[model samples]
Target: MYKTKRTVFIFLILLISLIVLTACNKASSSSGDEETSKEDTKEASTEPVELTIAARAGSMADALTEVVKQYEEETGNKVNVNAMPYDNLKETVVLDVRNNSGAFDLVMIDDPWMPEFAEGELLTNLDSYFPDGLASDFVQKSAALGKVPYETGSTYAVPFIGNVQMFFYRNDLVEKYDIDAPQTWDDVLAFAETIKDEEQETFGYALRGQRGNPIVSNYLPLFWAYGGTVLDENMKPQVNTEAGVKAMEMYMKLKETGPKGVETFDSDQIATSLTQGQVAMTIAWPSWVSEVDNKENSNVVGKVNFSAVPSQESDAAAMIGNWLLGIPRTSQNTDAAAAFLEWVTSAETQKEMTILGAGAPTRVSVYEDPELVEQYRHFPAQLEALQNSVARPRTSKWSQVEDTWGMYLSQILAGQLDIQEGLDKANEELEGILAK
Candidate 1:
């Protein structure tokens, strides 16, 4: 009986030992599998992706190139940048999309072209990529411009440049005239008149009145401030209304104090005139802010200050012309492109980009960052203008409309057509164009 009891005890011990050994083996295998899986994921994420981007050429593009360099280093990715003139960007991207050629993984777009791209289904729905929706750091108007329906549609892009027309003037000039900063259209006109009369060497204003987009973009702020709109609520032509006539007259009056050959001044000429200290004041974009302060490019360094467009019967309103970044639907590496997009537009990245002289920050927080504010004094006013700015009419046909209206407006500016007659003719032509 003692021997049988001992045997039973040994048998039970052996069974327990076997169970322990199996459990150890299973745990070891599981741990090995987990480690291998993690390593695989790491390898996949670190795999090199060659991303291509289409961007506008200039300092803005230079800024992006710098950001791309930082991104490549951080992620071990390769990037190819294609920077072209602004005039060619739309056509190039559109061709790539229409042909379903995945030549570019990302494209920087002007806000006005969002409608056409969205309508054509050329861009991916970026809203789905961000599980919680876009970060709320962006200014409302600037953010809205990236949506397909302006305020309501799914987001197809993110605002890459915080662009709004800002009213810039020489602070020293204003102080010298003993005039408080112009707060209204009347104030702006008065300042311009005083400067033109007193400062013989300096033109009072510098505005872009060149044919086509240049003249139209510069004029629209004044048009809206005077309660003039290109179209009424029903989308009918209203450019010949009383408000339109008044806005045009005010614009011409302001232009009278500008340089000789004002009718030929485009954005480049306007920016040069302002930085050269040949003009006392101008309504301009933040893209020129750096040039205005650079000692090499500007004679008015440390003297220029920016404000919102001057108010009139209506409160001040700026024209928002933000550029956006988007992924094309034909892109094979949407994930990689999206990663770059999110990284570039983040508040932290934007602050860095601002320091690098890229486009203006699209984030309100970036604009408000203490260090950034110190470096860019106009940031506060720029944020204010961006928040209050209005978009051009949200029509797919705006390009055609602008071409037609701009031609007539240019004719009027050159004394080739009377203001009222020119406006009536433009209204008629725009109606026909929109109808088609």
Candidate 2:
């Protein structure tokens, strides 16, 4: 009986040992399976994604194409770029987003168009992706263009190209005439008159006066400098104020020293006149900086200088015309699009893009990069101007308002209407527009 009891006890011990061993093995296997599941999920999240980008045609499109090539090669992703004219690109994006079509993952926008897109709820609010908000390294004014409610609301885009209006002048002439760097509109006029009289081949100034957006753009700096406001506190049109008339009169005087058909001039004419040594002074976008020094294109290489627009009643307010990149709300690849935005706007990528002769950079670091500043001599001045830039009116009806204002301003420039008459008419039309 004692032998039987000892054998039974030993059997029970073996049984207990086997049960515990099985439970340990099962727990280990379960843990391993969970880890495998997590790994699979992570891999799926990072899998290669195909994306589509809609970009403005011209140099912007070319630069983006080259950058996309590098991105695809590095990340094993595919990107199809659809480059079109500005109007067509805007229309396409609006249609796609309005229809909820997952067509364009990314789109390039002019800064002025932000209000329209934001008000329509067409863009994705990027606040979540950028929880900490935009980095301080971005030009604050340029970054503000991406925010809704004109710099106080959630971000909808990122400033991709830093294009601000810069004052360009023939430094050689300024020195020749012993003129100081212009500090006010009055000084610019005096200096311009001197240059026009002294220089036989060159006009004193060049301006964009073509009817629609061009004329309004050329006039805003002067308008704001004279304490003119496009709209009052109640959103009423103030284009016919005393300040507006004075600014228009000043604009007319500047035109007197320009080319004979200055009333019909546009960006191309303005840039060409300056680069070919035909204009002594002008306000132009940063894109023209390269041509001013390029031997192949410029006749006044190393003779031009850039600065912030001159002040009058108010301080200098360079008109900001930055191009922005945004993810469409209908984009099926939001994560991939956001990734591309962060990558492109980075200092490294912007530096690369600058080397390719892309648009002006939006990052402070890129503008201050030693190599870039050396290549683009206007970089420091450009950075200064961007930091002090001002945006156009932030209203969904800005297009209509600008169109009407331009028409009247063009008529005034063409001598078809006096300053007061044109401004009054513009204000009347603008009031009608905002009412709608």
Candidate 3:
């Protein structure tokens, strides 16, 4: 009886030992599988990738091309850039993503088009990649353009070009007129009048008076300063308000101070006017800053000075027109694209871009770089303007609104429609557009 009881106890101990060994093996196997899976993922992510980017033509594309060259050299990746004009690029990007074609791994976007892309669910949710959120070194307003709800919401893109409207004037001319830098629209008007009357060789101001985007852009700073809004708190058009009419009146008055055929000037003409010393003052983009200082292109090199736009009832608010980089939802190479974006927007890369004369820097550090500030004297003012900037109304219908509003603004400039009639007509058309 004692031998049988001892046998049973040994048998039970053996069974328990086997169960413990099996559990240990299973746990070890599971851990090994997890580690191997992670290694595979890491290997895949590090493999060289071939990517395609749809980039806007001109300096933006040129800058990106240079950056891509550096990125390829460092990562052993290959990138093919298909650069096209703005409208064509936008159409291709939208169509490719909408159809799930996966033709572009990445694309450049104008800030205003972000809403359309976001609303259509066409961009990847970038929040996951940026686990800690965007770095604070990025200009808040410029970086805000990447968000769907303007300054708030999940980021879908990063600002690539820090293009903001800058008030450009010939410092020599302003000083010659014995006036302080024009701090208010009234001040600008008076300065324009003085330059127009006395400096017969130079117009008081140059206006981007062409219809559509050009005219609307030219008028916005004025409209906003006068407390006018494209859309009120309720998303209603208020372009014909008391302030709007006053702004328009001021806009027309400024036109009188410009030279003949002011109704047809666009960016090229505006830049030419300022660089050639034909205009004493104008609102221009940072893209023109190089031209203003290039001795080969500018007659007034070292003479033009930039500042924030003049204020009125409201504080000065330069319009933010940053170009953004976003990965498409249909992209097959999103990881690689995100990597490139992270690299490009870095302070170091942006500084290189600025040095290459590609585009304006979106980073505060890059803008404040002593070397860059020295080369581009407008850097300081540009930084200030970017910080104090305002984005256009965050509506997918902004293109339509700008179009209708531009048509009337052009007419108002040409005397084809009176100010009140033009504003009323534009406001009505904008209402109809928003309703849709």
Candidate 4:
């Protein structure tokens, strides 16, 4: 009996030892599998790459930064943004690309610079990447500006900002005076006069009479709508034509109704005047439209109404001033940069961007998105204006032309030079530029 009991105890001890060893092996296998799965996930989600972007400063810069944050969070890629001043961005990017400094993998370019960059083969031709062509939802006018040949050619850039000039007015004041919305420049002048006389205001209009780009851009719509042309079909200067004289005369006439110290007003000042409800009507851009509804920045919330720019003998033509994103030919991270470019310009991202009130949409779908249109009352008009817009002349020399021409326009506006004299001088200088 003692030997049998000892044998049974040994059997029980052996059985207990086997069970413990099996359980330990199972636990170890499970943990190994879990670790392997985690490793796979980490490899899948993170690219372990870094990208640099040259972006413009101000609200546009902030907006791009927000987009980059979303990209980094999803992909675990390191992104460095270089936000340069608007005045310096072009020259800086040009130098970086010309020297292949590799400082910027991606760069934001103004539409006017597209020709120069394309001519020099400084940017990647996205045609191979977008073999099916760009998304159809992009505004045709805005997208066309991204092509090397203006309306057609290989796509080198993507329009990031859907900007076109717009007409802004105080709806309450329009109603108070019982005036119909102006359809022509003549009507605009008349409206300005009525507002000045009936309201006993010092200025009924807000004009950006500052020298250089600000004043030139503000005057072009009027110049175009009055059947004037800065250059003829032959690319020769035509600013001294009868229509040109008339347009400048009308511009001067409108200036007569603007505030004192108008010569110094830039976009910011024009925006401020309208936001404060101090101006009756102003020619504006999508960049300024966002401010009218912000309680923090504007006193004219819900009081300002927008329309396509007014016309005269010719149809209304808003000027396209879009920002574009392009990859440098020398970029080492072309694949990553292209991915980011495609991602940010997607309709989904653009809609998300609008929700954040970043910038205007380049996608028609975003523009017509019912929620967006309801929230931004100017969207329909903005879309119409974008469709009817004209781009600056597709010339590599546009910057120089604008400089010479805008200087003369400013001189005329400041009363330092005669209108005819300035026009003739601008025409001669432009001819000389085109000759080259």
Candidate 5:
């Protein structure tokens, strides 16, 4: 059966290759499924289609490459991967899909992005394509990201990367300064003030000051903590109100302890600022654990403790950073993608990847895997964060909403616009986007 499928897949790839689109200067995409199709044995005279698998570069990409190679070797099909710089992945996939470029056969997309892709009909739906029905093994939370709201509708993507924000702090500093681990926004403010008074060199925390995703992601926990939200349950923009104001006010307070040029700092800057001992605490992804303890890069090796991002006025709010995979409507081989996806997301593969610290699993079982637990000390805390994590609003206008918010955030952090004005302008723009 497996051989038959492989033979059929290879044949389909050949057929698609005959209708050459353009010079294939191959670039892999992130969770952007191209138009896919299927044909029978009789209509099989075309050249094989090469698949471009796109994802972020780093340990994550390296891990994916290993698995991808295994797939290629098992089948005679070639799968070329494009490992993008994290900053470029978002724009690359979105732009390509919008143009219907079909540059990427399989893309690893950010979970927040699924709404944009699915709603626009840019991605291939998994339900009608996966012949055996959707696999039951995918983790529920991760699976939920790809879900269409009504009637167990078709999923546009499947989860691959399971990421969540975790809070990290210097345990020694927490103890020495007689500071309590922050329990809420109020606690964080008080702690930052205390750190300012006691340790001039090390502020209480590091906040992403850069514009776009960085700054916005940094503020979400605070926004939720103050009971302000960008949208209500009905998906309307409501970010310029009382709760929003309170959250913005608190966000500015964080600037006190953050790096000097925080307004320009992205993930790299914030991570460098915190792990190198510039600040006492920071909210970061799990990947930071490796950076902090690498002795070669960190001065404060072996001194950090990781936990769920602290909460007050609200429980801890971790941003869920998940990636989803799915077949595209333009694909000439749904069967191949389905087989490959099932093989890739299987329990054994997830375990191997997590153990290697490649891609963390969405499955609960992998969280308790002994080797993974040993390697990643805060696995339990990470899982807790994942469970309590907040997903960005899922409307077709999210891209524009993020653009406006990101721009306003830059202005606010730069003090070019006061928090209220910036937020007010953002809300207005977001509403316009939704109304449009």
Candidate 6:
């Protein structure tokens, strides 16, 4: 009986050993396969895609970097950002996109450029790429800014920056001067002249004197005030008419009260000059005014207050300049780019952006945030202006028009040509463009 029991125990031990060995081999094989799959996924992503984003000046690049870094950490992708100054973008963007150099995978452009870029099919239509697409998530006006107009269409770009021209002045300065906030465009011109003649060292106004975007930005308010439209309802050049002539003449008068080197003025010059208290009142954008409102660098903090642009007809007609985000046709990472844009434009992200001064939010919910209302007392005024805000003529020919009119304005301001003559020259150039 003892011998039989020993035999049974020996067989049991041999059977257990064989099963253990088989289980170990199976686990080792499974582990090897998992490692192989992981290696393949890693290799597939190792192709070294460097997404180059070309943009104009604003706080956009900084805000995008935080999101991009998080994306890179999770997905192991790389992003390279090129923050181009506003002046160089128009010329460089066209060259890079047309050449198909795969140089810029993403680009930030002013809203006016959308018609041209989208019509040319230079930017990829974002509809095919974005997952939760533009369905009622965005405000209508904001959404319209990104779509191809007058046609049922998909998104061509995302509105990342909501920039509108606002009028700002020093409350303390106005009170001390016994000046009521100028209610009319004519009042503004009169105040500007008083500051120029009496203030002596300080300029009545600090205007953007640089050509192209800078000059055009400064002149548009005057154009609107004088009842001039860049393009009529029929999209014809109405820029040299009686209203247009009056607008150009007002621009000439602005030059008379401006700083000595007004021709060289740009955003940096205007912002610093305003905060330094050299300027009494000026038509500035949210981007520049934010700089002056900053506690760290601003001298006019708690002293500066903003108002709507004084009206020539109804109110000062400030031009709306929106910056949009879009993917390029050559982008290999369209899915990722669209994902980022959707997230960034979301209400939650836009609130965070507002706190960081990334730009204004596109959503009505965030725009009416109580915290923002406390911070920006002019929010009510701004909201009204935004609702009625004028977008530049939605045409593919804007790039050429901006250049032609911008050059003509510079010449008029520089005294190289009379206002009428300058507009005459601009009209000829525009007529040719219209013909083409």
Ordered from best to worst TM-score, the candidate numbers read 3, 2, 1, 4, 5, 6
Clashing pairs in 4: none
Global lDDT for candidate 3? 0.90
- Of the candidates numbered 3 and 5, which has the greater TM-score value? 3
Give the least accurate 10-residue stretch of model 2, judged by summed lDDT.
190-199
By the lDDT metric, which is better: model 4 or model 6? 4
In model 5, the runs with Cα more than 4 Å from the true position are 1-51, 73-77, 85-104, 128-139, 150-152, 178-180, 357-359
List TM-score per model, in order: 0.88, 0.91, 0.93, 0.86, 0.81, 0.76
Worst 10 residues of 6 by lDDT: 379-388
Q: Each model's C-alpha lDDT?
A: 0.88, 0.91, 0.90, 0.87, 0.75, 0.76
How far off is residue 263 in model 3, in Å? Answer: 1.3
Predicted candidate 5 versus true structure: per-residue lDDT over 1-436, tens digit per residue: 9999999999999878864533242322221223122343423523344677668787877787777777777775667778999789878877776776767777787777676677667777677656554565555666778777522566777778788888887888778877777777777778777777788678777888777778888888878777777898777788888877888888888887666877888888877877678787788888888888887889788788888887766677878888777665555555666667777777788877776667478777788788778878878888788877787887767767877888897898789998889888998888788887
For TM-score, candidate 3 versus 4, the one ahead is: 3
Maximum-TM-score candidate: 3
Model 6 error, position 259 (Å): 3.1
Candidate with the larger lDDT of 4 and 5:
4
On residues 35-92, what C-alpha lDDT tens digit does candidate 4 reach at each position? 9999997886455678898988877777777777888988878788899898899888
Worst 10-residue lDDT window for candidate 5 reads 27-36
Q: Write the per-residue lDDT of candidate 3 for residues 1-436, one digit (tens) a residue.
A: 9999999999999999999999999999999999999999999988999999899988778877888898899999999888999879888999998888999998899999998998999899899889877899999998899987778788999988899999998889877867899999999999999989898699998888999999999999999999887898899999999988999999999999998887998988888788889999999998888888788878998898899998999999989999898999999988888988899899999998888777588899998888888778888999999998889999999999999999999999999999999999999999999999
**lDDT score for residue 18 of model 3:** 100
**In model 2, which regions exceed 4 Å deviation?**
1-39
Candidate achieving the largest lDDT: 2
TM-score of 4: 0.86
